[model samples]
Target: MKTIAVLGLGKIGSLAAVLLRQAGLQVTGFDQAAKALHDIPVLSDDISSPEVLKCLCADHDAVLSCLPYHLNAMVAAAAHQAGIHYFDLTEDVSTTGFIRELSARGNSLMAPQCGLAPGFVGIVGASLVAGFDECRSLRMRVGALPQNPTGLMGYAFNWSPEGVVNEYLNDCEVIEDGERKLVSAMEWLETLYIDGVKLEAFTTSGGLGTMCETYHGRIANLDYKSMRYPGHVQLMNFFFHELLMRERRDIAGEILTNAKPPVDQDVVYVHVAAEGLVSGALRRSEFVRTYRPIEIGGKPRTAIAWTTSASVVAVIEMVRNGSLPQNGFLKQEDIPLDRFLETDTGRLFN
Candidate 1:
């Protein structure tokens, strides 16, 4: 059996271990916290430590990290040293760039930003361009929302809170006039209606993956943003920026995590729109996907967990199936759209 090691057994990491084990890989997990993995064995080691991570990677065919964005470089470096394929779900632009540089010369694959936004969002965007010849504009929006929002924030903690704050504060990368430009985060707000329910979308970091780089000079006015219920932007901005909670992210995270509970009845909303000429005719293609809570093996998993896990699983399958280059950096756009939507796990989005 192929052996795989997962670093960081947090919420997402824990789910990933279960999914990979179910997929028939011999899995070993390492994390700072003592985790419950049912029948699977847990390896007590700190992956953030370079020495220990290198040793752990030495015995595994590949290393999948579910740690925060800040810890991704450490794991990537260790994976590079151990000659193992490295994969992560980070959306930090700088971190993805570093991973790209490492992939340029590495002997094994390094795939990052393989989560919901940079992950599945990229796949949808590329698919849109494939069907249209003279592409005009492409818009992609996604949200992991609580089914019953009961707080002033009107949200719950489904994923990384720190990751949420980083995305809000960072400058977003966009493609306008067929050129790359950095747009101020939280600007360019727009109201959207999904399923006849109103929601707001705005600039957020790393949701576009290398789309801007891939679609540059090919299309104009291509952008990606995060979606939230109406008034979420104004409320969050007041708390994050005005209250200066932006600097105290850890505190803000703690407060939110303590006040707002994680909900099982949550949904993941995906919307992709592409406008261009098809067969010498002006046209547009729009795909909207919403994943609700699903029960796998009597356990209820949120849409965020399902979507996020599938993102990494799909990419890993692609690499294993020889659909992607075995060595060096791999961009999300490097994976074909149809192939992605055709994979056994990829069909979940459908």
Candidate 2:
């Protein structure tokens, strides 16, 4: 864990490398084209080839992938062959399943969905459930929005459009009425308010990660949703369903990103709640936060970029220092929220 290779040096990936390097790890970044970073060294290489990926991973203590979800399975397989811990911010359910299979055969740790909703939100939800004697339900929601939103959609493409589109179209996993079932995304729409800001939430895939399996028989109701300004879901449904853009994910991503590119000023909203009987009495616990862009590395980063980067970097910090298990599949719920908040990079969440 002393040396790490960060693959895909995009905005979030580049920032993750910087945070890890700042925390005193020997970090190297791999991408198609090397971007000039102040202190950290980035290498340009064709990692799409499996041989190149394996050779690159063989040199590092761990490999943190920031590549697209479609490529994570290949990168993870390479890391497993190289015998190093593998981490990624992927929310693709199939990709995570592939990583889970690889983790069983390798001695190194394999952790996926280690960012934002699937990462930090799961940690918070598990912490809240710990207070109840018998937990009945847990609800988690997160949103990355433009601070000053415009248009009927009232949204911005601050994250990967392919990821967003996939979430919107994929089947979501939820434990409802004591049954773990798959439901259509964008269904189960509900309205919620965080800090007096009105928002709408709906079921989204991969936001729950592996929580449904971990709490399958223990909890009666468990779900995760994506929050957005009001009327966002309806327009998205029209764009994807009526317009038939769901089949054209690549073109849809290009269209959406072209229309609503990443914004410098954005906000991340998180709402998590758990309910059950505590000491034989019904009770509820909630964790709500409104996070905005902050100054990092002498520049302002978008809320989505930093929050997503910090969560994974903090987890890496914990693993490097033995705060987290070093081998096998790492589940988000297994991470302690308090301890996670204490890491140098984790302090950003606080």
Candidate 3:
């Protein structure tokens, strides 16, 4: 897996290629047009064709897709047929399900949901209770927001607006009171504090990945949510419900992104907690951090960009070095947090 090809040279994709190259791997980028991003060699080609994608993927040992979720099934299918390992940052549950099915028949690894909320957060949640006797609950919350806000929404489209919308509208999976079930998104609301800053969290889809299935019998309660500034969720509920924007997610996403475009000065907050019995005593473990835009390749990148990109890059690094399984459907909960932090790119999270 020394030679890697990154598809979709957008914000996260371009930065991921730079990080992979920085990790000492041979990196190439692909997109609709050939354009230089940082120091990586980018090639322009249409990946919509299965034949073209399979041919392109065969040339590399692995393929990392940073494309939108709607196009990932095709990419994974191509990778499967090419007998090359595949990775993606998709948070779409259906897309992950399709990839999981594809992985069953393929010899190479198919890893998806390798981004921040579903990726690193899942890894952290499992690590928090690794030594517990009886895991009680695991709660995870993540947010990427404008550092300085001046709007009713108090957000910026630093991440994929489509992804944000999907998380809001889609039903969330959870394990409540030892029973696994589906719950309406945005129904469970809670207030949390980090460094004395108040914020709100609500249920969101796909953030839990496959954790419900993995922790069904082991954990009593488990859930994931998205954090936002105070009053942010209220406005969203009103906008989607009262204004009837839920019927048209595409248009809603477009309108939201245009109103609050991405900002250079942004922050990403991650807070995770797990409670269980340690030594016959109730104990709680927490992993909390606030990430801001940092310098990469002598230029600053947004917090959302670096966190999301570095996450998958580190997982790929581990895969290349044999720290992770080489084939089959890789679960984020199965990745050891210690080994993940030992990787070159994963160290950035520290």
Candidate 4:
């Protein structure tokens, strides 16, 4: 069995460690808060110390980082120096660029943005794109929403509040007219119905990581958006643009964190649609999935936590089994959707 060290024993990391252990992989968890879960062994150490991070990664076959986006660079560097594979659930584009640079110089695999939006959505989008002879347009949308929302925002904090703020403030990347371009977040708003529920989608940053570069000249129009209920975007626009919260992102994050209630009974919605020429006719392909909270390792976990963790863990399993490249920067689109769904970890998203 391969030994894997998981850094940051927070909600997602704790569940990931449990899933890894249940899969027969030796798991060691580390966190600064001294947090411990049911059966996983944890080390309470300062991960900010370079020596501590190196020591923890030196002996493990691979290290999965569940820490905040800013802390990923240090852990990724340590993993590279230790010659161990590195995986993370970061949706930060700058952090992923740093990891990609590290992967170019290192001999181990580095995979970032291994979560719901950029992870599985990319896989599904790629599959849809592959079915087309001449791809014209592609749109990917994903959301983690409360089953019963009672807040004014019509949303709950199912994941990191900081991540939510960052996506709203950063510029989104897209391919328009077969050219790569940067667009403002929260723009190009559109409404769509899913399962008889009306929801809205808008441009979001880092959700389409590296796909713009991959399909730049091939697809005429390509973009990724975050799905939310109607009126959510208007309130956010008022908060960030009208109220100048974008200038004070830290305060904005704190305000959202303190105000928004965290919901465990949430649902993850994924939808990818592609329109292009198939054979000799114009056709469209789509993939849609909705996931609810489920029990793992005899403990109940939220839909966001399990889905995000499952994606990274499934990629790790593929790398360990020689299905994915062992040494290089890995893209989520490179993992086929069907093959991924067949894995024990990836089955959760199915």
Backbone clash pairs for candidate 2 read: none
lDDT of each: 0.84, 0.94, 0.93, 0.89
TM-score of every candidate: 0.96, 0.99, 0.98, 0.98
- Model 1 gets an lDDT of 0.84
Candidate achieving higher lDDT, 2 or 4: 2
Off by over 4 Å in 4: none
- Model 3: weakest 10-residue lDDT segment is 46-55
Candidate 3 Cα errors over 4 Å, as ranges? none
Top model by lDDT, which number?
Answer: 2
Tens-place lDDT per residue, model 2, 253-313, is: 9999888888898999999999999889999899999999998998888899999999999
Question: Weakest 10 consecutive residues, lDDT, candidate 1?
Answer: 32-41
lDDT of 3 at 166: 94
Q: What does candidate 3's lDDT look like per residue over 1-350, in tens digits?
A: 88899999888999999999999989989988788887788888888877779778988999999998999999998899888999999999999999999999978999999999799999999999797899899999998888898788888888888998999999999999999999988879999998888899999999999999999999999999999999999999998888999999979999999999989999999999999999899998899999999999888898999999999999999999999999999999999999999999999999
Residue pairs clashing in model 3 are: none
CA deviation > 4 Å runs, candidate 1: none
Cα lDDT of model 4 by residue, 1-350, tens digit: 29999998888998889888877789999987766676778889888999898788877999999998999999999999999999999989999999999999878999998888788889889989999899999999998899887767889887888899989989999999888999999999999878878889999899998899988889999999999989999999999999999999878988886788688899888888999997889998888878899999888899999999998888888887788998999999898878888888988776
- Pairs clashing within candidate 4: none
| Candidate 1 lDDT tens digits, 1-350 | 27788887876777777777776678888877666687667877766677888788888989898888998988898888877898999999998888888887768989898888899888878887888878999999998899877756778888888888888888999998887999977888999888887889999988998888888888988998899888888987888889998888778877767777688889889999999998899998998977898865457778899889877877777777788888988888778878876776677777
Candidate 2: regions farther than 4 A off: none
Model 2: ten consecutive residues of lowest lDDT: 49-58
Per-residue error (Å), model 4, residue 288: 1.1
**Root-mean-square deviation (CA) per prediction:** 1.5, 0.7, 0.9, 1.1
